[model samples]
Target: MAGHAGLTTHVLDTARGRPAAGVRVELFAVEGGERRRVAGAVTNADGRTDAPLIERGSLTPGTFELTFHVAPYFEGFEAAPAVPFLDLVTLRFTVSDASGHYHVPLVMTPWSYSTYRGS
Candidate 1:
């Protein structure tokens, strides 16, 4: 795996117009209808994991999941509603190129969220 494949993520809070720090993120590998967690991390001040969830040379071709804990994050915001609209946001995607980089970015608010595969 000389040209290793890896995965990274970034979280942005649109409501606050800043990075979503302290957010808990989890990575899971899906296989035969069973899900196994691969890694867990907390978003840093820059709204990014301290290290790639899937480090270089470890990624493989398969379906994977990234879960973001949002309710607890919104709880700290005074502008958030009494009952948050989002709790756990999970993005399920497949990695087809084992030698390419995958960057999943999450942009979210209390009521809405979006994600995309970036460079």
Candidate 2:
């Protein structure tokens, strides 16, 4: 995990125009048609996990999922929709190269969300 050769993520709260602090995020490895928990962390004040969800040495070429607890994160906010449009937001992707860095950043609101590969 030296240099930029692991997996990282960032969460942004579009409604608040800031990082989605303290939000729970989970990483899962998909194998044999089943998903198994790999690692998990809560976003810090900057909406980033303290370390790469997957370290360089631990990463392997495979399919993975990053789940963001969207509804729960917005529960404390007053403007959150009463029923919230999205509960858990899961992004599934494949890693063909274990030594390459993967940056998955989420831009979200109570009603909508978007994710993209980042540098």
Candidate 3:
């Protein structure tokens, strides 16, 4: 379908008050209790992927997952803990409407993280 259906993501480092650049992200499509990787992306300087994880024409109704690799990004900060409290942050969500746009954004720290359905 050539609607606006797509999947996008961004990561913000709340502890450092900046975008968490160079963080690794993996996208997976879940089916029948198995996870199949669909794509991978890396956040840019603006904490956003260069392209949508799922392009407009390619989105569909299904269970999808996004795993953010955060520990290494936090390690660049001076106040980062010796042992990180948060590491791989995985967010699983469902896409019920193929014509809908899904913007999943993450605001994170070394100790905590949060996400929301963005515009």
Candidate 4:
């Protein structure tokens, strides 16, 4: 990892059976009725960001969202539709422990996506 440990994410393009590179990822902090941008990064060749999206000391106990720009990625591919079934794939999760490391990964295709807590 290139960043201080806190929160991380990985993305896989199941449709092509490869790591999703150049995908945009955004992190948001959800506070009550308002959502604020915390951090953002693009995936590398390995389907992972160069740094932790939320660095260690910056994380707190609250709700957060990781939105992946999927539609644009598939647009350049030959098999994807002009208007894909999925565009922005957002994962909303809560962090109850600021001291803990959270790794959330997405395995996705044009029409489907799945995610879970990662090691």
C-alpha RMSD for every candidate: 1.7, 1.5, 1.6, 2.5
Q: Report how far residue 41 has shifted in candidate 2, in Å.
A: 0.2
lDDT of 1 by residue, 1-119 (tens): 33546999989999999999999999999999999999999999999999999998889999999999999999968888899989999999999987898899999999999999887
lDDT agreement with native, every candidate: 0.93, 0.92, 0.91, 0.90
Residues 27-86, model 4: lDDT tens digits: 999988688999999999999999999887777889999999999889878887777889
Question: What are the per-residue Cα lDDT tens digits for candidate 2 across 1-119?
Answer: 34788899999999989999988999999999999999999999999999999886777899999999989889867888888789999999999988788999999999899999998
What is the clash count for each candidate, in the order shown? 0, 0, 0, 0
Candidate 4 — worst ten consecutive residues by lDDT sum? 1-10
TM-score rank order:
1, 3, 2, 4
Per-residue alpha-carbon lDDT of candidate 3 for residues 1-119, written as tens digits (9 for 90 to 100): 34657999999988888998999999999999899999999999999999999888788999998999999888867788888888899999999988888999999989999999887
Residue 22 shift from truth in candidate 4, angstroms: 0.4
Any runs in candidate 3 off by more than 4 Å, and if so which? 1-3
Best by lDDT: 1
In model 1, which range of ten residues has the least summed lDDT?
Answer: 1-10
Per-candidate TM-scores read: 0.95, 0.94, 0.94, 0.92
**Residue-level lDDT for 109 in candidate 4:** 90
Candidate 2: the clashing residue pairs are none
Using TM-score as the measure, which candidate wins?
Answer: 1
| Candidate 2 C-alpha RMSD relative to the actual structure | 1.5
